[model samples]
Target: MKQTIRLEQFERADIRSALAKMNRGIERESLRITSEGQLATTMHPAALGATLTHPLITTDYAEALMEFITPVSTSITTTLAQLRDVHRFTYQHIGDEYLWPLSMPCYLNATSDIRLAQFGKSHVGRMKTVYRQGLTHRYGAVMQTISGVHFNWSVSDELWPLLAAEEGRENNADYRSERYFGLIRNFKRWAWVIPYLFGASPVLCKSFLKHSSADLDFHELSSGMVYVPHSTSLRMSDLGYTNKEQAALKITYNSLDDYVDGLRRAVFTRSEQFADIGVQTGDKWQQLNANILQIENEFYSPIRPKRVADSGETPTQALERGGIQYIEVRALDVNPFSEVGITAEQMRFLDLFLLFCLFTESPELSIECQQATEKNVNKVVLRGREPGLTLMDEAGEYSVQERLAHLFAEMAKIADVLEAESSAYHRALQSFAPAISNPDATFSAKLLRMYEEASKIFQHVGMRFAVEYRDRLKNSGYEFYTEADFQKMAAQSLAEQAEIEAQDKGSFGDFLAAYFEQALDKKKRA
Candidate 1:
């Protein structure tokens, strides 16, 4: 039923060098809130450069929803340092606005207040905006405003050959892609562990649920605060990032080809629900198209196989050209306790856990198994701290604690291998053991406990953390970038946006048509 790689079979030098050299990057998202804790109505900060071309700072679904990206790095400490530099630089320009510390947005009086992120007049820029509009027409803007952290990572290139040789397979692109897919499948099987450990959004502002009748059992602390008593991340729950429509697509990870085809089909497939809204309503481009997804980016999942797409190349196209170059983990909630939303230890833990995913036995997921995985994730998202809660696996039902114990036991060997580079790997792995026996020791449980003891409303607590982090980031010096460096990057991004606008040709309609005309076949046509 499974095939696990024995750590003893690999040479210690190979283990030490390969695992130590893995690449990591972070995309941290935060909503800009006023000093009064209301969402900011300002456009993207000019000093942060064009959202379309900025290398580090940009906006997400809403202009106020700021996203800071770090360059790839081989060291966890260096990656965190880069992220810190970005945050400090951003704080310098945001003027009085605070980066909301939590994953969920601050209270919003109306959905109309959430503005779609804007780019310049270029065809590519317009397409980006139109696609977001499509999301709004499909799902509400409030849903898009909820922010989280994305961890982009890739195993060392050297490690793949070692793994290939161990498995008696050729060390080629196909082999690499196949192994990465195996990692993805295994990641899916144990994905619930992520939210259970790092989730911080147990309580939500009462206004978040004002417009809809979501079927959830929430305890109201006051008129302003509502939460699930034993919940971990409400952000990952049905009330937050979960999508009912996308669930029907059933994208599988049996192979790179199947995964690519599934994404392409979702992009091309028409949706009657989206069609009812119409693509163009009264000259305003309501959406890009009436497809189930405007592009591959719209298919939300806990994790994704990724590649750095060249200009004019779609995600699927890039995968077809070179297979998966990396993976992006999307399940982490922004840790409110940390100034930069994540810690170096958290990064180390992720590296160890992902390696465990790669080396473990991953079975092909049938549709039934996929649904079971979803159920397992949902259970953890809603009631992760519930005592004695059981979850489904290939080997029938098991206690969540039992499953975690097994996972950590397997990961200990990876930590040992990685310890050759730094003892911190083992330390990070060992840090979560306390949470296994005591749910209150977990981040979500601690966050909720802190909130309850503070005797303040949920939004008030969030605002306090926002202000605290803002002040700290403003005062703390940059870790990796200087003020001059950020200034030059901003100027360069502005120039790039202008050049892109100047080089544009044809109407946006023609550009959109040509974009959709790209073939989904294996090789690109000349």
Candidate 2:
């Protein structure tokens, strides 16, 4: 069966109207418990934002969205404490727990335009990841190339539960639980992402994606997850769900039978499976989308290369052949100080911001675009907000701060359209505009202001995380660290790597050359 996914935009009437209707169910308070198992009475809103809660969604007064407001929260504070406060105010739903440490954002089919965010057909092998050992969803599985554009809606369908379902919080006479969604702005360490940025992926993120109840003749099952023997490797071709012919003829994650069926399920009639016609994203929505392109540019802020085939082929011809069709947008910075993670204004702005990326309508970068990206990165790092810091023109030609100003003005107009649609989205847009206006609003500057220096920021956040983890483990009566955890894990891992390298029997450059050779060979075979 042939399957294609499309980004589905909702009409403003439908989008806003649905949100408005849903407003009746929005909770204004949090519902969490103290270690004593009694309600924590003496707490501030920021306290609620920082608390770790379970059961993803809730209507409890202790962990409600309205309790954390995104409507009117903008400040010039740089301390992690303050940033954390605002973040908590925005994303009380996704607290520090439940953080999935994956290199890329979990791929969620948002509007049809999201595919455009990945590029129509410019990403291929990027979609699939292969571990040195065979696995599909862990350290080395294909991540559906989804880099996030900050200040936008979340990009995961899994969010439906947190946003719509009240998981726990039963037996409260004051209120009834309803499906509720809130901003999720917890900024966790991104070790999973470090490898990707360093270009070590399709090699790391391939572990288990599914669990089978039992083991087989080739492998044994343990702890609900199928064990992958260390002796084997899972190739990219092994993960392709393109069609039956490309399936590797062997099931790795699940039994061959189960794998084949799962593939069918993910692809066949996928349109029907994703049948939730978004409430309504109308003309105003499109206006808000395209307009975001004019104002604040966010995509240009982050660096991520979209891997395309070196072979010369027209975009049209490549699409026909299912060639390079991937681009991962990685500009979003973790709201490093937020309790909840991020804020509503950030989310709303992001919705428009992402559309802007998709609609940038850019093709292959001219030397100019490449240089522009380099210049922007430099400016962002050192002089992000030095009055009239310079940037490139839309044509990627001349360098001019006036051009940057002009771009900002145009983007502001788009943001205004978004503001016109819903007070929620509009307010969110206006709230974050100041940050976009200067470096002070960016996470980096705020971080500097917080600790009074870069090193201090790291120490403070690091200590905070360390303290939190210690407390968590202590509370759970668990071991936080051991000799193996501290030292042996790394030593053992490196030793294992040495062994693998020894068995491969190649020099460093030779290994890289050999890897490419095998990759190309596999591609040609497929």
Candidate 3:
């Protein structure tokens, strides 16, 4: 039977007090490419501090790709303001290099042209680089270049204790962790709504399809852009980060222990396909190992249970020590229209949506339900706004509009508990209603129309957005971090990086062996 949750479970007076203290953080990733629309060949800017040690600014898979992280804040407005300050500060440092405004890359000549992010001579630093080497060997560098935003969210500590009291349970990490897992399961079931509303990458440069034998029915425009009509986010589809090897792993999220066990096994178990590639060709190291995953972070998912790791503690170890501190939402595309790639309205809606996931009574997800969820997500990513589209529930198939309307209605109840001014959340739902009724109002459809009107020149549109965003940031002074604050952070990060490099006394080979053994030992102890 489908689980049902009553609104009366959260009486307004009690829930309203808790809602006012929730925390949120955002991590946005963007590729830094040159002015003429070529991938940046330059090293990460020295002015930006060490990528390995910097708290706010860091490099992702490629040296050219930059990721900006905001410190956790209770106010949604404050988090976004901090993100904008990071952007403004970064713009001052990256001379002539434009942050790619869209989720997809602008242009690429070859895979070799993209450089894996490099770190200095620390054992940990080397491991980070070697892991990227594994990723490039496992998946092409072009796929790694695709960028997106990650939203990290959590309720206040007081709120958790209140929830535990209401449930007549112990206010401990175990209870909180289990509840967070329930939220994760519900997110998996309903997260299709995210991509349907915010998906922005409906098209790609033809260069991305150069080497692969992907059988996408791409329609080519006169100016050389390829797209699948009615597609919402090609970035989330098979053409982007989807891998058959990882898919075969069947990672489950029914509980914290089950999820962690699946991830642990995948990391340790060697893959024949990767083994054939070999870990080393003579003296040079090829990858961390021939395992399905080099580390826990490599197990990509739409959402993850997160805990702030202690000094020298692994991600899994942190979770083992203290249950989940927050959940990271990874499904959002970089909204091309916004200067900072995300807006206050989007964040507000996300807050409501995540709360809905938490409040809803989530049933234990069976393997069949898991597969159904995947199907629904795939349908939304590819053709969400197609006229009269439908998604499957355990009961049967239903129209997407009907499903969304029901979801919005539930979300409104959450909004009331949040004590939010109804406009932001209400307007978001109302605006999305049109996309359900008419496809052209969707981000993908509007983007495609822009491309058509611009004579099919994708680069032109992308470049225009890039320049406009750059100027916007350049003109706006820092709202959160000051110039002195950035300078201090950069210097501190450099010192930390140097100290780490100096502290390393073991060979890379020995370090790798110990890392794997330690993780295995932890799992056994648990």
Q: Estimate each model's TM-score.
A: 0.97, 0.33, 0.96
1-526: candidate 2 lDDT, tens digit per residue: 0111112222333432232221100112222323322222323233221222111121211111122222211221222233233323223323333221111222222212112111011111111111101111211222222112212122222322332333344322111111100011001011111111111012111122331211222232221212122211111112211222222222111122232233333322222211332211431111111111111111122322122234433222222233222223233433334333344554444444443332233233334433444444433333344555444434444333343334344445445444345456556555645544443554444433433342333333323432353343334421222323323433443454344434544333343344333332212201
lDDT by residue (tens digit), candidate 1, 1-526: 2334477754667656777799999999999988888889999889989899999998888889999999988988888888988989988888888889999888898988899999989999999898989888788888888889999999888888877777788887778788889889989998999999999999888888885467898887743677898999988887775556689998999998888889899999999888998888665899999988889898999999998987788888888888889999999999998988999888988987898888777879987898898899899989899999989877788888877877777777777776564588778877888888778889999988777765554347788888888888788898788999999999999999999999999889889999888745464411
In candidate 1, list every pair of residues with a backbone clash.
none
Predicted structure 3, TM vs. truth: 0.96
TM-score of 2: 0.33
- Model 1 alpha-carbon miss at residue 299, Å: 0.2
Model 2: how far residue 515 lies from native, Å? 7.2
Q: Pick the candidate with the highest lDDT.
A: 1
Q: What are the runs in model 3 whose C-alpha is more than 4 Å off?
A: 1-5, 420-423, 456-459, 523-526
Model 2 off-target regions past 4 Å? 1-326, 339-344, 360-364, 394-409, 412-421, 436-438, 453-461, 465-518, 521-526
Q: lDDT for every model?
A: 0.85, 0.27, 0.84
lDDT of 3 by residue, 10-35 (tens): 78566668766778999999999889
lDDT against true structure, model 1? 0.85
Q: RMSD of each candidate?
A: 1.9, 23.5, 1.8
> Which sections of candidate 1 miss by over 4 Å?
1-5, 456-459, 519-521, 524-526
lDDT for residue 483 in candidate 1, whole number 0-100: 95
Q: Which residue pairs of candidate 3 clash?
A: none
